[model samples]
Target: MASAETDSKSLFSLESYHVSEEHGFILPEPLEELPPYYKPWMDIALRVPELVHSHELRSHVNKMPLLSSTFLQKHRELRLAHLALSMMTMGYIWQEGEKNTAEILPQNLAVPYWEVSQRLGLPPIITHADAVLANWKKKDPDGPFNMQNLELLVRLPGGESVRGFFLVTLLVELAGVPAVRSIPTVINGVRCSDTEAVARGLEIISKSIEDMTDALRLMQVYVDPSVFYGIMRIYLSGWKDNPCMPKGLIYEGVQTEPMEYSGGSAAQSSLLHCFDELLGVKHEPKSASFLIRMRDYMPPLHKKLIQDISLQPSLRNFVQQQDCKDLNKAFDLCVTKLLALRSYHINVVSRFITVPAARARQLREQNHDSDGEIISRAPTALEERGTGGSGIMSFLKTVRDQTKDTLLPEASKEVKHHS
Candidate 1:
């Protein structure tokens, strides 16, 4: 038991880790030299926070082409990833409490964000980009990518206090790896009508989902209601004004103009979409659907590829066959695990955010001035976002509920009947 504890501690030891100056997820180049078109916005986003609300910034973003010729002319994929990361980072810091903003973001975070916002036809604002980019790091500059290290870094935020939320995030990232690895195999299997190969991919994804849920259960011990709420107050310090919980992160320039959308974050969770494609789960026709519109936020190439793969008659036929029970089971397992995680989050939000917000309101009411000039404590932006007063918790809960309804009983049952 002692040895197991030691091993676990060493696995998360930061002394063994370092930021990879080269070959890190974020490009090493300075923000000053990239995508001349986005520099103006970057300047305003980094320096003049108030300027983002003005029409000038919006006008500047409006005039830029959706896919800048410069982006198409260069390292398209890498550049797109960089831009997405930067915009998310800027949005994250822009809303962060004044105290956490002192560490001026390195160029690694600045350049690509501005460039990507131009490409995606959206203003450079805080979104799910921050959540995805927050965990990128490496033990050695030249080392291969390690998901364990990424998981460890995520736990560093609130330490033991907010370990549950960070642990869930880590498990989510870890879960996506096998899904990503199985992509090529699944695609190739469909192309060749190899049901066995497709089955193999499904097995891997199912096991990964199970593992993720198991990992999430460990969060129960680490999550103390009061402590977790306090930690969130610190983490969400920057997201007061922006209450929209982004659905996915946009990696590619797909739209001509910014549209009111969610699901950009879903793009990061590649496994969920991969399941939809393999099982022929169509969420598009449904109104206000959580996962359907996520495709709009994905890069054009990726979105197109997923669409093409889904359209393959062989894959759909295989999923519909009675012999594909194992594949169907695997798909169901993934959905169940995801729902479990969402349920866990909902409970945590209720305890940490919803309840506290209600109490804070009660306290304010009780403290009001007798003379009708109501004496009150002005809540900080972070406090407001943290306490569920900003509508973030409600938005998140609605998305989760919608997803739960959309997937369970109905979709799973349909797939089973077809099989």
Candidate 2:
């Protein structure tokens, strides 16, 4: 009986060994660095909780030369990453209504922020997609819906204003996890060099992208354009104050400070990044491009898994080798869906930004006297503009056409010309 027990133990050990060997060895990937500005503020928030409540820490953040053209030119990627974190942190806090008044972001931060955001072609407000992809978690020890503990875990040094943003962030994670989680399975299957496995993986990823896209679309109605625009307008006091006004908008803190800089838009969405990675697309290199540094903002393990999967033999390569038209179609379908979602956002934001700008122009023109002497009137607040008009529909269609032209360059010219 003792001999049998020993043999059983040995057999179990042997099976474990074989399994390990079959899987092979993969060194754990290294962690990416967080944006430099993030850690300092986080350290201060952790060590001195009271600092978060005052304007002191915010003043210090404003002092950073994150928005200077020279600095941005030098630290393009890191600066953009920092700008996203800073704005989201501040916007999430201030929008919660902790303090009752609107404050302006100082010029040092405001000008460059607007310029950079424009250069990147992003909107000033944090979109549903941005919050979802940036803050989603694979595992939550606290129940997924538990807001109090989640606030503790996410720990931005803001007051109750963060609650709504936090809730949205949590909702995004809950909505997106199933799709995000399936990514690794797809990666591993492709690594196994099994054509069936590859096909299954492609199907799963395509479906995952579609589901996430649907979840993002649902947010369109829930986001009140007026309220969102109102909040953003209050933060733009510095831009209003600037003689260079309409060049772009700047976010000034509500707590009366002289600091100013540019950039409050949600950084490029992580879903976009995921698409780029999976499709093996590359954009121009900057000192620290969004594609490269955005990973710093992701949860470490999640980022690592994405990196690992990207290094695997690409799905595109596999499709080519197998001559799989179906797989190619699935991949193209995901891209088309993503582009459609982007078009939707462009339409929505054009309503928010372009619609207001157009209205303000019309009001100014209407106020002009017959002699061309303008009768001065207070500018209409963006929120007060009733949601109306085709509002940049033409511009959006042009953008869609350009995107299709760029993304589907190889398709028969007739399809491209149909528009």
Candidate 3:
């Protein structure tokens, strides 16, 4: 485990990045005055628009406008689920341990439920029950029923069943919100690079789990559900690093082995390779990465059908020769990578670059450097040499000048005559 001091130093000392409001990156009301942890996560939220526009991600939100009323409805529901599920797991763990801290939670920590929620947001979702009902009513005035009627028909426990109901609804919403769309922002005070921010977020999540080991065991009732929630949140926050998880989940239904980041099924391998090349993320096929993968890895048959082409020697040849088997596939991959790049560029670079001249002046004080100005002034190897040095002639000149300056007039004249 990383020491807290080291982690803190890494985060706070990181180079500061600018945040953008023009691109849906408004500082949340709850986080403006708080510590830095929220900034990284808010940065994640700010990138969702690009995700929605991505060819790879368009299917997730194609039905609605980016962050429209429908999107927000899903977002609210997912956030609610994230909080409720985490809290319920904590409660279950507390009860299972007979309220004993030793058997139910990590040492040196008291708060559990909300703390975990703070660590994981509900995997951002694309659907909401209210949205669906509203849609049904608008399209079919005599719609068969509503969520309330459906719940009654199913005979689920009064409101408790909402979790399960929401679970399915959330999955439907997920079609609109790719696992990659809901990245978890590592909340900290550090000014880190993009890679560092992701690393810190993962580290915090891992630590939070360690701290909750005892609690996790006690929360048997909530284990599977919490795992489901945790797994999704984990991927949403770091899908690029945990690509295998989503890949496995999407293709194999569960993550069983490490994914090959370089190559595999021609369609997928090519896509993953492009994603890595464009995004600089090396996805590993780890156990925790499955759920997110499952969400994206449509089965071979579906992929074939979706591409609107019958598979034969041509598809293979296309993938091998052209480097992409189908137009839709290529389009999707292009969109995904482009959106991912745009998100990073906006969240990590534009925000800082946009800092007002006044603020930049204060930050650099004597330097008076804008972010671009500093970047432009980066040194080159050849520029490192001092102007006074070249070779023997330069050295000789320096020595002569010094000797002449240090000598008395008579001594210098005598030395010159002897020479």
State residue 29's C-alpha deviation in candidate 2, in Å: 25
How much lDDT does each candidate structure score? 0.44, 0.41, 0.25
What TM-score, over all chains together, does every model reach?
0.52, 0.48, 0.19
TM-score of 1: 0.52
Show the lowest summed lDDT stretch of 10 residues, model 1.
Answer: 12-21
Which runs in model 3 stand beyond 4 Å of their true positions?
1-318, 321-344, 352-419
Candidate 3 RMSD to the correct structure: 28.3
Candidate 3's error at 158, in angstroms?
Answer: 38
Which regions in candidate 2 have their CA more than 4 angstroms from the true location?
A: 1-173, 233-265, 284-308, 364-419
Better TM-score candidate (1, 2) = 1
Q: Return the candidate ranking by TM-score, descending.
A: 1, 2, 3
Tens-digit per-residue lDDT, 1-419, candidate 2 = 01222333222121221112211111111112334544543343342224444545455555545434333333234333333544434443343232332345555455544554444343333332223333333234445443434432233332343334434434433444444444444454445545565556556655655654555454444443333443333332222223323332225532233333222222223444555566555443431243354454443343554565467677666555665566556555555655565576676566655655554466566764423321121123322321211123443454345435433333425445664
Select the stronger candidate by TM-score from 1 and 3.
Answer: 1
Q: Write the per-residue lDDT of candidate 3 for residues 116-155, one digit (tens) a residue.
A: 2233321211112111211111123344322333221111
